[model samples]
Target: MNDTYKMMIVDDEFEIREGLNSFYWERFQFQVVGLAANGKQALDLMQRSDVDIVLTDIKMPIMDGIELSRAISVHYPHVKIVILSGYKEFSYARDALQAGVSEYLLKPVDLKHLGESMMKLKHLLDTERQSSQKLQSYENQLANSLPAARDHFFQSLLEDLLPEYHEAKEKMSLLEIEMNATYYCCAAVKIQWRDQPDGSLTDANKLAKATTIIERHLEASQCHSYTLKRKAGELAIFLNLNATTVSPRKSLSLLFDHIIVAIEGELGGRSIIGLGEVYQSLLSFPDSYKQARSIMERHIFRERSGLFQWDPADSLHMERKEYPYSVETKLLDAVLEGNSGNSTMYFQHFWDSCGLDSEHAELPLVLRYLTPLFTMLERRLDLHGASFETMANLHMPFTEYVEQFQTLSQLKIALDRLISDITLHIRKLNDVVQTTSHSAVQQVKKYIEEHSSEKITLNQMADLVYLNPSYFSIQFKKETGINFIDYLKYCRMEKAKELLRRIDLKVYEIGELVGYQDRKYFATTFKSYTKLTPLEYRQSFITY
Candidate 1:
């Protein structure tokens, strides 16, 4: 007997009811809950027991089958019903059909046809139940692993999995997603509301509606495809170029030009576009993305409505310059020593040393010169374990902040302000360092062990305990037998070994849990620490 169906028989005739219960029991494989003489008894039994299907005679004493069908249709639409009748009563058949009856069987019901109908209904019911369960399971999984899914998608893009046009289309469909076309680009859009409008326009739903409207109009009018995601109160578009199948080069170039006009025109010149270069492979997208953002950032002093393209052929081209590592080394030393005076002096020298002799004079050149400086200064602050709170407290944004600065001169002023704030911070940091204590050294060690998985530096650890790095290092070796950096690495390797025993987690997840930020580097370190690869280590511990 198939476990898929439970049947209930409702009939007033004793002979017909008895015959159906006995003859069809073994052949049709349906388990009868109990036989009822009328609709009232059938409904009562159904409420008390589990029934998947019901067979009811049309004419009964207490209540009729039509009334029962209507009640079941409303209360349990999921439970299927087959009406049993004698005579060719068209009215009864129509009433049953209207009430969502599964089938109508004649009173000397054909056992063979009844068996076939039950089998078909059973298969359909099982299929629909499984489909619903599968959907619920998928939604649960998605809710639990949203972060991992985001990482996987980004990693796929970075790994060049989407190379050909067809491959990209197929991949998106499998994920229940769609994108525009190949040759992707990204632009950050910042929307500032005037006085927050009214309640109607300020809610999340309203913003979502606006986004939908924009996407629909863009796609319908221009035949472009795009995915929009919100991050940090800014809207970012992962856009694909759109064009009919034609000359590859011409199609791509023309599509990009149209994208630039369509996107800017829709925003009514309220946004700046950072046009990334076209790439044959998705893996190269990040590189192109960097260019687009840099291009947009570097030309901030120009007209706000101005459109810039990363492709060299579209506009003025500038070659990327590499700053000397020696300059970085010198700046790092001054910052570490907490000598704000020397740090300021070295930064000025670093600026003078930048040999950027460009002809397209104005915002571009200024941005170029400051880009490297901003990076170096940011690194220094990061090395010191500075938080966003610290930056705000200092009344300065990091020198690399590109959001508000419009001109090269404005950037210079921002940087100058940052330098002043950094100098004050340095003096405060240096004072704490010079007066380091043994307890402070112990505190640093404890902090390192606790946060081994996170990115950490010597200066940052020292800052936590309010100690000078130079003096702190001396005391740390005195207390722990090894240098601060060595101790931190040792702690990380120990944690990795413990994690290696847990076979459920992937190697990458384990590596992320450790102090190592670079996966390759973590793998190498794990192998060095325990003469086995992470996978091999996990395999050894598997007993069953």
Candidate 2:
């Protein structure tokens, strides 16, 4: 696993070899593994030892630098050879280059140049070593490729919303398909690390070790249909929830409790899990994924490591409503000011404006509302396609505030401080933009959002924003993190959420209101947004 280089130096003069060994060892950060007085001796040592680099002087008794270089090029193609010539002869340099010498240095070489050459050789050695190690590791992993591939294939099949049973059986003969068994329930085991007493899981290696330990336990279990999948820093065990053989809840409980206790007892990191709803057939796997993601997202509320069952009853309890744009702006401004009062006022107003008391709470609503604005700012910066870091260091951290902020009163104070700081930085960036693009995007976004539900064309939008259509389209997409069409679709979809919540209208009517004339197209669009069909969404709210 260790792949740092071991270099060998050969020369007729002992002082020369010693100087190179010591100088390269200390100054250039290379290990002088071997030294020889002649090329034959050096070749002998190199053949026996795991050498990555070779340095040899020209004009030796048995083998000169050119001959040695040729031998190394032929025998150890991975080894990098450096030629040291006392005479500044073109013939010697040409022969050295022909023999595949990696570098050439004249006698009485500057220590600086020697150190630089050694550094280059060291890089080559390290790169070769890493490549060799990775190739070997890949080969070793390939030994278990059949079973790993089988597991992956099964997992894919289980995860597919529309798995063709016959095709699956043909591809995987070992599955032994039971066609009559249509009711498929899913059990998910979420493995999480316990929180540290220091309040941060900064040690990534330690967290990975904990996850590995939990995954090993599941692998040893007799759950035939179980497959482990890791995503977004969480481990998920997908199980076929068959009521006949085992109860999904009981199975989930045993795994969660066992794993949670184990993680707490062994690793010092927080752990929590939420079981998904029992869905029928492979076609409903998307539902299972949503369930898992939804559950995991709420792990912050579950207090780290805890077992949770899928209960639609908690559906109403989830979802944090979006903070209004003006309030968010004010909150961003408050954070910039480092003031608690204004931030609190904005934060409270945002939540109250959202009216989460009557609807499902969501982070997406807030993140979607805020991320776009930030992205717009980032777009406005135009730091020659510089990264977010290169752009103004203005960040509101609304998600953090929403998640960790305790009391409504405390959140308001924190919100104001957050808003103030953000607004200050935003103002500075706005000034920067005025000198450049005049924040053409700001006016463009306002127009787009205002007319998202209207039949507005790109040309019209471009003209309104006072930019060429082509350039505006490019800049708009770059600024908003989405194309104009996509942005419009997103805005309309968001508007549709409000319309859907109001039980007064039909799906088609809402579609037209959102600028979609076709009801079928609207249903598809709504599904794309909420993962629920328009009818299904309406049914979710039906009290009768």
TM-score of each: 0.32, 0.29
lDDT of 2 by residue, 1-544 (tens): 3445678899999888887766736445557889998888988887578777788898998887788888777656667888888878788888888989899999888878887878777676667668867754654464335456655764674554233322233333222222223333344444445456785455556557766766566545533244455554455555443455556567657866787777777766566666666554444444555566577667755655777666666677433332244454455344333345665576567656766332343455545444544443333333222323443343445365456644545544554454455444444544443333437777877876676545556667767866654445545655787656667777788888766765545687677667664455577567867999988887786552
Q: What's the distance in Å from true for residue 158, model 2?
A: 19
How well is each residue in 480-515 modelled by candidate 1, as lDDT tens digits?
Answer: 887666677688888888877754456876776664
Off by over 4 Å in 1: 1-152, 155-173, 180-183, 190-210, 222-233, 245-269, 299-303, 313-544
